[model samples]
Structure formats: structure tokens, C-alpha cells
Target: MKEGYVIRDQSLPHFLTVTIVDWVDVFSRKSYRDCVIECFEYCIKNKGMTVYSYVIMSNHIHMIVQSNEGKLSDLIRDFKKFTSKTILEKIQSEPESRREWMLERFKLATESHSRNKNFQFWQLGNHAEEIYSEKFMWSKIDYIHFNPVRAGIVSNPQDYIYSSASNYIDLKGIIDVEIVQIPVVNVLKSSSVVKYNSYEK
Candidate 1:
């Protein structure tokens, strides 16, 4: 992993990107995407995870998250491990059109790493960038929300059902998130620095 991508502060919010092996579009299916949502819910309920914002793309996920227990690394490790096993099992058992193709890609990915016993679903390293400033935090959130739009998936960020952009727009999302309150002033456009306000419960 690169030096800048390391999660030095586990308790602070960080912008994280977790991609699938070979960037396979495994999450294009609703079942697979729901699997991810279930895992996130479990983490939040049991692992002390505090998700500010998130977006699930075709082959990757972006999250602005922190850990109440200050164990972000462990939370991430467990999340990937459990989700990998569960999703792989689902692919094998469920009626998937791309079952063999996806399984082959996952199996081939394990060739480079001896850690994986059968398949490597998620690629290594979260590419974590700690949210050091409010501006940086909001920028990542915008980047995450606009991903689908940039990919031409949706015209509006909130229209994407799998993203927390809906929550920010006063709509209920697939999962609950700690909504970060944007400053009253238009700090994003200002040249001066600004601090993050408290989150809305």
C-alpha cells in the first residue's frame, strides 16, 4: 500500500475505496448489491462503524466512515472477509448469468496472493484517505455521489438508489447514515479554510 493511502487515524472519518478483483461488475446485480448493504448494516449494528456517506458502484464502493471503537482496520478486514465468503457462496448457489465468468475472475485473482484459499473477491488495500478537513470531506462525498452521474447511470445523484446521496437530500436511503451537516456559509466555494460542523442524528 502507498504511504498516503494508509489509515493512520482509525477513529477519524476516512474516504475509502474498495474495488473488486479485476474490477468485475459483480454489483450490477441487485442480489449482489443487497449483499453489500446487508454487510454494512451488520457492521454498523455490531462493529461500531459510523458511516457518513457511501456509494456502491458497479465494481467498487466508496465510503466516508469512522469507527467508534477506533478499530477501522479490523472493521474493514472483517467486512471484506465476510462479504467475500457470503457473496461467493451466493454466486455459486444462486441463479447468476455470469456465475462461471465471475468465479473464474475471482479464482484467477488469488494466483498473485497466497492468502486466499479459494477465491479473491476484493482487491487488497482500501486506498484510505483520512478526512483531515471539512472541504476535503465534502469533496469526497461529492465525488462519490457524482460517480454514477459521471458514468451516466443517473442524471441526479439522489436518484441512485444504492447511494447515501438520497439521505442528504432528505430521502431515505437503503441504510442509515450519520448525515454530516454542511456549514451555513458556502465554504466549498470560499478560498478560506473552514471547519466541519457536528453531524445530524
Candidate 2:
């Protein structure tokens, strides 16, 4: 709705990236990151948002998600709105060293946007790309899971506690994700084969 970014099919899984205002590393704190986790979990439980994979970085979150209720855009709008208010409140009440600086950035961001009032925590528009094929889906998933590794935060993707890679590897993570099995036509075996069989659970 913001221009080129369009959720053509609300029911299909989409790779979404939501960034913080001024690229602020708000999620550098576990408490703030947990706030995002809580909101995603709530959406999964109550809003029929099926999350295939997700990773929370220092300033942004990348998620592969689809809405069962055909309201992906609406879900994202509410998610941004809620997280903005919740995180701003946390920054105000909590003992944050960068409290004033962060609030000022939020205030400036709000002033730049007419729709926002007082403060703006997240940047406008989600960089969304719909998954049209198994290759594309896996590519995006790998990108999301390996973000922390690419950023030199961890040696292995699974070592990042804020990503769904742990869950894919049969390890416990911040939250459980719905693993989508990719079906491939194997020319070697001359049959269709499924990858990620361990994720059947």
C-alpha cells in the first residue's frame, strides 16, 4: 500500500523486513527483543499469522509469514503500531542509557511522518517479498537465519538465539516456528523428494 511493496496474495508466505527508526539498535537489549518476540507470538496465537521463520537483528526483524485469515497487511500494521507503543513505553520506564537520545530520534521520525503522533519507533513500510517458489523461499529463509552470522554476531546460524534456525536444527529457540518442507523433483532418484524431513513435528 505504500507504493511498490504489495502483498498481492495475503494467504501466501512473504519475507518481511521491519526496521527501527534511524536504524537505531533498539533490539540490542534482550528486553526489547523479547517485546518483539511476544508480539509475534501473540499474532500467531490470536491473529492467525503463520510464521515459517524469523530472525531479530540489532535494528530490524526478518520473517517469513502468511496470514490464515487473509489479512497480512492489516496484521503488519497492527504489529508495527503495537510494538512502537510498547517499545517506546519500555524505553521510557526502563533504565536505558540511550533513553533520551533514542526518544529524540523517535520524535524526529514522528515529525517527518504526518500519520504519526508524538513518536515513531519503526520506519514506514515493510520491505516485503512474496515467496513464489521453493528456491526463493529457502533463499530468503537462509538470508534471515544467517543475518547474525553475516553481521559477525555468531559463528553459526543456529547459535543465534533470536532466530528460528535453532528450531529448524532440532534445538530450542526464542519461539517455535512452522517449518515448511520443500518438495523437489529429484532427477537422481527419478522421484519427488522432500527436504527438511526432521521438521515434520
Candidate 3:
């Protein structure tokens, strides 16, 4: 961990962004991104992680998340450890065009730090911001959703399959998310809202 980047309150939800080392486009391929999706699913189902929203881009990922066990930091650590090893293995086993270059970069990153024994996949420190209010939460969610759009990958956020936007719009997503349920004050004749069942509702 880095100074001032440690998780202080594990109970609160956080907006976290994790980038690849050296900004490598490791997730440009489906297999690499699938590894991330698998990790997210495994963590959510078994590691007590609660993911409200997420987006997987070419070289990074953004998520709105916490942990049911109040061990968000531990969950992140485990997820990164497992994914780094798995992704590195895949890069070695699979026919990757940039295998040598990518492996060299990861090896360099690992050598630069004493914590790693072989390679470093994710960059140090998750840029995490604690979510305090509904407004801030929505802002972070929108920012996460529009990342691909801002990068010109897609025009509509919902069109991006590797994001929570489809899940929010009631589409079957790559991974299930625990949507936050905001309290509703009133309902008009022609207007109603969907409510989600989860801990942080």
C-alpha cells in the first residue's frame, strides 16, 4: 500500500480505480478481461465483496464496492494477488503478440518492488474515494459508466457490455451486481421506481 491510500473505514462503500502497470493494454483481449470478470464473481460470491457497479476497460477497471465482512482491504489484496498470477499465467500460456514485452514490463515492475517475487500486473495503490452520500455515489457511478464513452469506445454507456450500465437498465450482465436501493418518497400515477434489495439500501 501507499501512504494515505489505505482503507480507513471498511464499512463504507468506496469508488476504486485500479490500473495496469505502465498503462499496458492488457485487457484489450477477451481472455484477459474474462479473468477479471471471473475474479469479480468469485470475490462477490465467496469473498464477501459487495459490488454495486463496475467497469472494465482496456487497461484498467473502476468499481463501486465494499465488503460484507468489513474486510474490503483484504478482499482487494486477495483479488489482486489471484488475478495477477492468473493473468500472468494466461499471458504465458496463450499466444499473446506482446508476451515478451508485457512480461518484461511486469518483471521490471516486480523487480522495482521487493513485495513481488516474479511479476506485477496491477499498479500500486487503488485510487479509492469513500462514498458518503447518494449524490456522490451517483456521480462516481456515472463517471465509471462513461469512461468508455469519454474514450470514444462507445456512444452509449448501456452499449458497453463490460460495464454495470446494462445491469442498471435491467439487462442480463456479464456479472450480477448488488444495486443500491434509495428510499422513495412518493409515486405518481404514471411514475414508479425500481428498488433493489441489498445491505446498503
Ranking by lDDT: 1, 2, 3
Best by TM-score: 1
TM-score of each: 0.91, 0.90, 0.89
Best by lDDT: 1
Q: What is the lDDT of candidate 2?
A: 0.84
**Tens digits of lDDT, candidate 2, 1-201:** 255788889888899999998899999999999999999889989999888999999999999999999889999999998888898899999899999999999899877688888988888888889999877887787778778878999877787889998888765777768876654466344221232332232
- Assess candidate 2 and give its TM-score to the true structure: 0.90
Q: Per-residue lDDT for 159-185 in model 1, tens only?
A: 899999888875588999998777558
lDDT of 3: 0.83
Return the TM-score for candidate 1, rounded to 2 decimals.
0.91
- The per-model lDDT (C-alpha) reads 0.86, 0.84, 0.83
Candidate 3, position 33, lDDT: 92
lDDT of 3 by residue, 1-201 (tens): 454666789878899988999999999999999999999999989999989999999999999999899988888889888888999999999899999999999999987788888888899988878998876786777788778889999877777889997787655689999876543554232121321211111
Rank order by TM-score, top first?
Answer: 1, 2, 3
